[model samples]
Every structure is written in structure tokens, then in C-alpha cells.
Target: MFASGLCFVGVTGIVRYLGTELPAVQSAFLRFAWGVVFLLPALIGVLRSGMPGLHLRLHLGRGVVHVAAVVCWFYAMARIPVAEVTAIGYLNPVLLTLGTVVFFGERLSLRRVLAIGVALTGALIVLRPGLREVTDGHIAQIFAAVFFAGSYLFAKRLSGIASAGQIVAMLSLVVTLALAPLAAWVWVPVSAEQIAWLAVVAACATGGHYCMSRAFAAAPIAVSQPVVFLQLIWAALLGWVAFGEAVDVFVLLGGAVIVGSVSYITWAEARQRRRVVMPEVL
Candidate 1:
């Protein structure tokens, strides 16, 4: 989890360094294009296994949501401070919790509800939509978070029928195909330096997901959930050292509150899992 967090921070730093010189959509496509290179081994593995049949539509849907999310995220990373972007991304899990309740018909306990409320309050503080003029980057992050939540939800559904590697491979293929045209449409001349940065972003993103999967396998979700909070700290430090961005007090306080809420929600989820029934012994 720690490695995943660090890799993700590195990816964000690279994206921020790239800035808005290229269109966000084109930059997002390049990120995925380069990332597909890292997934080639996993793609071969899935093909050799052939256990789960590929669901092209499901993968395509996930890719669509992911493309939108990636575009927004890249845009936000380019225009906003990395720490702020990372802080706003806390909303993804919050939305996922609510989504399960609404879309999956999962029961939401009072504690879970209260926790969600607190997390949203933190988001409001970070966004400060009331006082500050919400820029396009801020709006992008908001929508991107929602799309990311949707992408995760779809991934969870796919996981029921497919191995993680298979799902990831399919997602990569679909994303590459979907974004290829966009990359061509708004293509810009790329220098070797930019290519190097994109390669780093790709490597970090692929490695981050791999590490996250390993973390989940190593520990229960309850244990792993808290590790994600470390990402905000890492992001803040990277943003400061790399970009001279300062962390705001409100973002810290709000992020803490949001983390607390998410921790509570994770505990609740584990408790619910413990209560699930099993078939009688034969």
C-alpha cells in the first residue's frame, strides 16, 4: 500500500510537471498508451489462462468512464496543486460507499450515513465552492471523482467473473483503442523529455495498481484502507518539494475528517462481512 501510494504520487508529480501544454485529453491518451506497454505481460498471462471470457462491452464501459476520469484528473493535476487534487479525490471512496447502497441495494447503517456526511463536509471545505470561484480544474476533479467511483464499481462487478489480471488487461486494451483517435486528433509534437515523463507516469501507474492488488491480497480491506490515507501526506510533500505548493490548513483538517469517516466506513464494511451467512457443512 505504501509503495502504491508513493508510485501514485510520482505519477501525479509527472503529470503536474507536464502541465497544460498539451490538451488534457491528449495527455490522458498518452498516459494510457504508454501504460499499455507495461500491461503486455499481464495481457499475455490472461490470454494463456483463458479462464474468464472477455466481456468486451463491460470492458468498454469501464474504459469510457476511466477515459473521462483520467482526462479530468490529468486536467486537474496540471492546473491545481497536487495536494488539493489528491484531497478532492478522497470523494471517490465516499461516492463508492453511497453507490453500493443505491446501486447494489446494500444496506447503509446509521454510522455509515453519518460518516458519509462528515466526509462530504470535508469535501466542501476543500472545494470551498461557496467562497472561491470554482475553476474548470476543480469542476473536472469533482466529475472525475464520480467517474472514478463508477469505474471502480464496474471493476468490482467484473472481478466477480474475471481474474484481476484479466480485467486489467481488458481495461487497458479498451482504453488504448478508445483513446487512440483522440490522441491522433489533438496530437502534439513530443520531445524526448516529455516521452520520458510519460513513460514514468505509465510505469508508476501500472506499478501502483499492481502494488494495490498485492496489498489487498496481503491484508484484509479493513487493514489496507487506512494505508491509503498515507497518500495524501505523500502527495502534499511531493507537491511542496517538487512544485513549491503549500498545504492549506483547511485541506489538512478536512482531509483528516474525511479519512476518519472512511475509516469508520471500512470498519462497518468488515463488520458486515463478518455477519454474512455460509452454507451448512455437508
Candidate 2:
């Protein structure tokens, strides 16, 4: 999971640099399309299974939302400081909980409500809306997280019916196709250097997901997820050392709060899952 965290930072760092030379939508499209190219071997068998067995609706739904998330994320990466982008990305799981309540009719328990509030409070601290004007980049990242939450919800809906590999593969392929039109519409000249960098982004992003999947399969998500906060530290450090962006103490404090809330939520969900698996004592 630590490795995964670093890989994600690498991915975002590359995206940030490459965003200077290409449109966010096109860069994102290339990332997915390149991911599909690299993942072709793993995807081949799933592809052979035909459209009916692939759960096309869920894949398409996730792909659409994921494309939006990626585009917004890329846009945010270009316009905002990497640390700010990383800090705002923490809203994903919080938003995911809200998405479940809205779309799946899940009950909003008190714990969840508080967790949501804590997370949002953290975001408020980071943004300080009254004191500072929120940039378009900040708003873009928030939107990115919302659509990412939607994508995550769709993935959950598909979990029972598909294998992990299939889920991962379908996301890349479907999202690549979904992003095609946008890429074409806003097409621009991309140099080999830019392509090489986006390729690195593809590798890091995909590799990070693979590492996280392995960690999740090895243990309950509750155990592995907390380590994800390490990414914020790494992102802050990377921003400072690599990009010369100063770390804001408030961003650190807010991110810590957000991570704490999200970590508690993960532990709670894992406990619930264990309860479902274990028989009652009577």
C-alpha cells in the first residue's frame, strides 16, 4: 500500500507536468487508451467472453463517470498545486457513501453522518471559502471526486458479477472508448516526450491500482486503507521538493482530519462485513 501511494503520487506528478503540453481531456484519453494497450493480455480472456457476460451496462456506466473524473482530475492537476489536488481527492470515499445513500437507498447511520461532516469540515478548512476565492481548479477536483464516487458505486454494483481482473480491464477499455470522441474533438499536437510522460502516468496509475487490489485481497480494506494517507504526505513532499510549492499547514491538518474520518468509515464497513460473515452466538 505504501508503494501504491508512491505510485499514485508519481502518476499525478507526471499528469501535472504533461498537463503543460496537452489538453487535460486528451491527456486523460491517452492514459486510458495506453492503459488498455498495456493491459491487453490480461483483458484478452475477458474480451473473449463476449458482451453479454461482461455486464455492459455497469461497465459503460462506470466508464462514463470515470471519464468525467479523469478529465476533471487532469484539468485540476494542470491548474492547481499538486498538494491541493491531492488534498481534495480525499473527498472520494466520503462522496461515495453519499452516493450509496442516494442511489442504493442505503440508510445513513449516525456514525456515517458524523464521518461525512468531519470530512466536509476538513475540506472547508482546506478551502476556507469566506477568506479565499476558490479557484476553478479547486472546484474541478471536487467535481472529479463526485464522479469518481459514482464510478466507485458502479464498481460496487458490479463486484458480485465480475472478477477483479475483468472489472479492471473493462474499466480501461470502456473508458478509453468513452473518451475517444472528446479526444478527437479537442485534438492537439502531442510530442513524443509528452506521450512518453503520459505513458509513465498510465503505468503508474495502473500499477498503483494493481498494488492496492493485491493489498485489499490480502487483508480487509480497513487495514490497508489507512496507509493511503501516506500519499498526502508524499504528495506534499513531492510538491515542495519537485515543484517548489510550499505546504500549507491548514491543508495538512484538514487532510489528516479527512483521512481519519475515512479510515473510521472503512473500519466500520469492514466490521459490518465480518458480522455478515460470522454466525450469531445465540
By TM-score, who's the top model here? 2
Per-candidate TM equals 0.92, 0.95
**Whole-model lDDT values for every prediction:** 0.85, 0.89
Question: Any idea how many clashes model 2 has?
Answer: 0
Report per-prediction Cα RMSD to one decimal: 2.6, 1.6
In order of listing, the candidates' clash counts read 0, 0
Local accuracy of candidate 2 as per-residue lDDT tens digits, 1-282? 988999999998887766556888899998888999998997998888766635988899899999999999999999887878888999999999998999999999999999999999999988889898899999999999999999999999898888888899999999999899999999999889888888899999988988888898898878987898889999899889988889988888888889999999889978988899999899
Candidate 1 whole-model C-alpha lDDT, 0 to 1 = 0.85
Mark the regions of model 1 whose C-alpha exceeds 4 Å error after superposition: 45-54, 275-282
Q: In lDDT terms, how accurate is model 2?
A: 0.89
State residue 93's C-alpha deviation in candidate 2, in Å: 0.6
lDDT of 1 at 179: 82
Cα lDDT of model 1 by residue, 1-282, tens digit:
999999999999999989988888788877787777888898888767655335656777899999888888988989988988888898899999888888889888898889999999998888888788789988899899999999998897888887777888878777888888988888888788888888889899988988998998998878888878889898888888889998777777777778878988888778777778645569
